[model samples]
Target: MRIQDAGVIFGILGIVVMMVIPLPTWLLDFLLIINFSVALTILLIAMNTKEPLQFAIFPALLLITTLFRLGLNVSSTRLILGQGEAGEVIHTFGSFVVGGNAVVGFIVFLILVIIQFIVITRGAERVAEVAARFTLDAMPGKQMSIDADLNAGLITEKEARERRRKIEREADFYGAMDGASKFVKGDAIASIIIVVINIIGGFIVGMTMNNQGMGVTQVLQQYTLLSIGDGLVSQIPALLISTATGLVVTRAASDSNLSQDVLRQMLSYPKMLYVVAGMLLLLGVFTPIGILRTAPLAGLLAVGGFRIQQTKAEEAIKQQVQAEQEEQEEVRSPESVVTLTHVDPIEFEFGYALIPLADTNQGGDLLDRVIMIRRQLALELGIVIPVIRIRDNIQLRPNEYVIKLKGVEVARSELFLDHFMAMSPGIDDPRVVGIETKEPAFGLPALWISEDMRDTAEMAGYTVVDPPSVVATHLTEILKRHAYELLGRQETKQLVESIRNQYPALVEEVVPNLFSIGDIQKVLSNLLREKVSIRDLVTILETMADTAAYTKDPDMLTEYVRAALARQITHQFRPPGQPMTVITLAPNVEQTVVDNIQHSEQGSYLVLDPAISQKIYQSLNEQIQSLATAGHSPLVLTSPNIRMHFRRLLERILPDLPVLSYNELDPSVEVKSGGTVTI
Candidate 1:
């Protein structure tokens, strides 16, 4: 067993031993001294405690100390009543200490018992009972406060748990104290009874049994002194313990210990001390007598106030000097330069005027909206988006905001804090009066309008959105478009860990075995780049495990994984009960691209003739335009072999255009050939 557990067992056993077995006089004397020391230590600790909860074991300790003292009392009573000499310590306290008088020591012992039993123990017990009731009654309010802090994001789950644990401990400690306070009162009553018994019974045994005809004076004096000494020793320690219990129960929780808290509060206003000192000086001058006493006391008060002020002034100077030194050190340190070397993955910066929209206190739902956005991305994109740092930049325009990806601006926009954005349903406008502008997300012609125009704009079949909603929608699209860039090695590792919890075998076999995390991240990134949700990660990795045997290329592995996840890939574009509209490349164009394809250790590339490449590009652009005019985002349907190559060719020129292989689409998804790209 542990030392603490062993010590607990040993202490209880020792208390029992002291009660049942007679101890030598010296050992009994030593135990009595220890009992007094324990009580004194408890009182000091109670005074210095910052909070009752800080000394949670106080109630239990109180009970143990009470029992130990009772045990010591029994042992000492046995020694004194039977032997007529308890110990040197008791003799000194009873006779020599009290000028060889028994009555005075008896009175002292009775006074100590009265102070403990009637005053300290009674008060602490009442306080403990009331504290327990109040704590139990306030539990719901305290719990609600903790919940509020958690919901406000002021504390983490771990911190919340810690706070809850502390509340429970407080309740239990006070409840225990309510019961344990009885031990002290009982010990006091028992001490008085034991003293009486020792005195009455000792006199009978000493005079009648031992001397037979001994004088009453000698017998009474001998037994009475020892009894009084025993009572004095027991009662003194009990009083100290009772006082400690009262101190602990009465003290209010604070950051500082009792002494420090008392000093700080009493002297918080040094001017009060100065005022009192002035009043004392006036009294000394006007009063008829005691000027000597009053003047010196006033001088001391004034000097104390001055010293307090001087100490405060020095502390403020020291703090300011230390702060300046720290600032200078930070400027000179290489750590700041080292910090600059690292960058946040995503950062959202808004103007000062737009602060209220993001500030939690100002009713900005932006932070909360950002959390929802992250969850949405995690579910849809199957990637954990990095923490998006939001900050205010005074350097930017008052109405403008910037979203940075890897320390560079990817999207920037301006918002009119006083108005909403209204967009026409199509290219046509209903002649609603508003400021003409282009939408940031889609470049659609839009208008900024006043709150009064919102109802009219909606009635005219226009899509209207408030400023915050507009920002949220724009952010959603931005996160979706750049999901690939955010899926780094670290994010991949997190994904792997999550997957391991569910599919340990698959993750264990694939990661660091078939491929590294970087390789996995690359494949996942490639899938995301095509707006494919890698949510079917099990199938994706399984496909990768099968395909990786032949090739180690992440690009080739991604294509195979996409083919394996054809159903998911198709569901994204081809909604249920909706036929997929696609534009196909002509057979000759595909063959010509395939014929000119070059492959080496670095993988596939196209080396088509410039004229032919230009012709193909133009044809595809024309078809894409026609498809756009028809209000459809048409996919480029090509043979599986040339799909990747054709997509690679158009990546730079037509990056937004999606190219899919025939095999990668669900066979059940009806395909309508919108047009043909011919060369």
Candidate 2:
């Protein structure tokens, strides 16, 4: 052990030695000072600590202090019995306290013993017992809370582990305190027994051996005073330690220590203090013997109350001024403007009247709906959507709301909270009349009908939905459409960490070695832009890792990932038993585009003339319209090399159209040509 740790050991061994060997008067007197100092130090520490576990070493310290006091009792009793005196410390303590009266001194020592052994020690022991049981019983719940925090990403694994260790230490501390309390009770009883024996034995020794020349009454008086003084010196420190034990055991867990908590709570209401001062002033005037004492106390209370009120006001003003200065600094700082460059991935702002749709007290479930939307996307697209911030804005119309992606508005709508959205089923209309509007999700004609008309609308085969459902559905659609914009390098890094558990080898081989996180994020974002599911990430990463060494272009890498995830991609647009009817480019049109494709170090672009580009755009639009009218999603089938360029050409004008290459089509999925795009 280091010298610091051995100090405790040496002190404990010194206590054992004091019990066996006799010490001179001066040394014992100094040790007496150290003993009282240690006990007072323990009490001060207990009062200042915020909670019990903060003083985790107290139980062991309690054992040491108890043993040291017991050893002091044994050594002092020996001195009084054999030498007819213990030390000058006890002699002076007995004389000053008892004033030469043995009866009074003995009574005072008994009172201290009664207070420690019967009251403080017993209560502390019971509290420790209950605390230990409760801490042990609550361990499972505390551990589960830590685990939940870890899973929710509120805390790291290291923090959770630390919390678990603290709980165990708490349980151990309480259990040890329960046993240590007994030592205190035993020490109190031993002090009484030792003191009684010292008085009897000291009187016999003084009469027979050393003080034979003195009378029995002188011997009895001298030894009795010495015995009471020795007992008082030792038990005083014992009393301090027992009180400290009770204090630490009874303390509740808090951020503030005992003194701060007491001051904060007691002085919290200056008005109450004013009332107290007034009452004391009244008492001073009404009572005959109270003016000198109560009047000054009343004056002090009034002064303290006024000072506290002034301090509280000053604190509030200081906080307000600091907040204003911070606001000014933020507005003037260039870095503050730069900070706005990083935007919230998803933002939902509503007008004043629409706040109830997101507020829980008004039966609105929009906040919960947003969480469900994220969970649904995670299950569907295998991407963890970033947090959606919902707040109110007074700038828009009262019933209007807007959803934004990366600080840019993607979708906006207005709703009537008192009405339901009613849409026609394309069958015969029953002519239900209400406020006419267009459905925000699908843009079909709809009406904001009243509650009474809900039944009528349903009877007419009309679809009905509440205002919250409408907003939630609109948010869901917008988030799904712009998901590609949300997937950045940071999000991809988190995904890589999550995927490392199942595909450790793939992640190790690819990330930062063959391809960086940005490279992987770009490939995934490209696929998501075309409404492709990244749920089959194992295949996506494996395919990219296998092909990234030779082909560094993310567009080509995305094509390779799409080919590997062909079954998943095809299953979304086409079922297993169904033959997918797709519009394919004619050979002449495809070959013309391929022949005119220009490539340079900057990047490749289609060099087709305006005439050719316009004709191709018109023909593809006509084909897509025909396909949509036939109730089939438009998929342009082409060769792999031309797919990326062909898709890019259509992206600016017809961004919603999905273009798939032949290699991306799964072999198990049946396919058939719907029509040819000829220009």
Candidate 3:
């Protein structure tokens, strides 16, 4: 049996031994005092500590026991040394063992104490069991983090709430049912039987002691136990101790919420057996000294049981740490990806990259093979792309190739025609005749016009290289380099100037001419489209700056100028759909919006999409400036993407804005489908 189980059995035996053996009066006094001290210590600390202080229990009990033992020795020495008369001792002993103080009151109190202990233990056990089961259902994983829940709009919010409620209700129902059944069938009946038997036995044993006169069983005479009228007055201290032992045992057994049943069992393994044995031996040693009058062994049993109970608390903390580790590992496995919300801004940049594809075999001539390759590339990358093939004298731009294979008759005919055309009247230059025939003269360009010219190559795909050391790699390298350069710089001045001078005609022509969208948008579009910039963000703080000046109903003059500049630089290069992180700010910070912009983690030092972040920064700066100009204290607006307003911008210096006041909001920003409204 477990150590705690052994303690319980030993406690029962100790109670029996007290009534049957009728321990010495001095010994009974020692038992009473020690029991009362142990009980009071338990109660005081239990009521005081917010969390159970397992370490305090042992020392507190020991100190109280030592103090009481010393007090008992001093008081008992006076009584044993003939300090009182024989008649007085006889009257006191009879009153203490058989009088009202010991019989009715003690019996009533023990019953109540046992019942209270049972209720407390059973309730705590139920709570732990329910909590363990609840944690199992909510284990953290990829499914819990990234997948759209009703809150995210991937699932309906109503559905998510309903599911959560259903789980809570089901758990509550099962827990309540189990608790009710266990209490009714188990502890309730056992408590009634034990209390009744103990009270009856104590009464019968006390009567036997009354007949024996001032013997050891006559508790009041030989000891300092209070005598009120006819019996020994056992104070609140002894009752409190017995009740405390029961309470501690119940709490120790019942309060585990660990999901691992095996661990709980290990923690609860009773160490109380050793303590019980030690207490039993101590009870015998003290009994010979006439210390315990009626229940020397009972005090030892209660103290031992309480000690074991205190030691079990460490198990709860250890189990909690174990559970967290297990759950963390389960959440991080390969199949699961942890999608973290950006509490603060985070940015990553990638430069140019080319991916090669697997080769395929087809039974086709060179020209057919080339056409097939072009079709395959288009299918893989999801775009219709231009391909250039170059070999001999004829140069191929995109979608064109040249070959220089000699031909006999056609070449001779072309030479004869060229000579005749040189002598002809209208074709004096000989070039006009060649042009009329859709051919070039000798020493000028000419083509044999083969029906089997190579259009596409099948087996392999090629990548671009910078500097074009090998002719084919040049095109890709140039485009990749342009993208990388765009990340760092704001605009290309030459492209901006050209687009500004040309307007619509240039905008239309420039887009197709550029290698990538970032190239066109970063340089040209900045000059023509909405020119959102850091400088524009700074302008919003001006005195009397209009609230709508940043976006929606911007004053248009400054906004338009920035847009025009952006159009010149980056109109063709900008990417679609801006992504934002949640940012919160301290309420008291001045210039909340503009100050936080420089530190935002939304982009790398260089960005693939600067226009998006630039626009957000500008709008925030303008709002803060507008607030300052209006004479309002700066207040931060928190959202997935934040807007800060510092009313009364004119009153304060612009350089004093506090940027570090920004913070990443919890859970990040919530984004939903069909959420964007185009302006």
Q: Candidate 1 vs candidate 3: which has greater TM-score?
A: 1
For residues 1-679, what per-residue lDDT tens digits would candidate 3 score against the true structure? Answer: 6999998667556654554443455565556545555667756554333222232243234334333433332333323322321133323543444453454434544554454445543454455355436534553332353223432335555666665654554445334433333432243344344334333433444445454454545534222222221112122443343334333322322243223433556435456545665666666667774435424565655665566567556667778899999879878775445444212111111111110111124321333444554464334221222333322212222222221111111111111111221112221332122222212221223222111211111111211111111112222222222222222222332233233333544444433443233433332222222212222222222211232234322222323333333432232222224222212233322233444444333331112134543444455566665645654333332322222222122114332232111232212333222111110
Best by TM-score: 2
Q: What is the TM-score of each predicted model, taking all chains together?
A: 0.70, 0.75, 0.21
lDDT of 1: 0.86
Compose the digit string of candidate 1's lDDT tens values, residues 596-658. Answer: 999998887889998999999999889989988988886898998888889889888987778
> Judged by lDDT relative to the true structure, which candidate is superior, 2 or 3?
2
Order of quality (lDDT): 2, 1, 3
Model 3 lDDT vs. the true structure?
0.34
Worst 10 residues of 3 by lDDT: 349-358
lDDT of candidate model 2 versus the reference: 0.87
Q: What is the C-alpha lDDT of each candidate?
A: 0.86, 0.87, 0.34
lDDT for residue 167 in candidate 1, whole number 0-100: 89
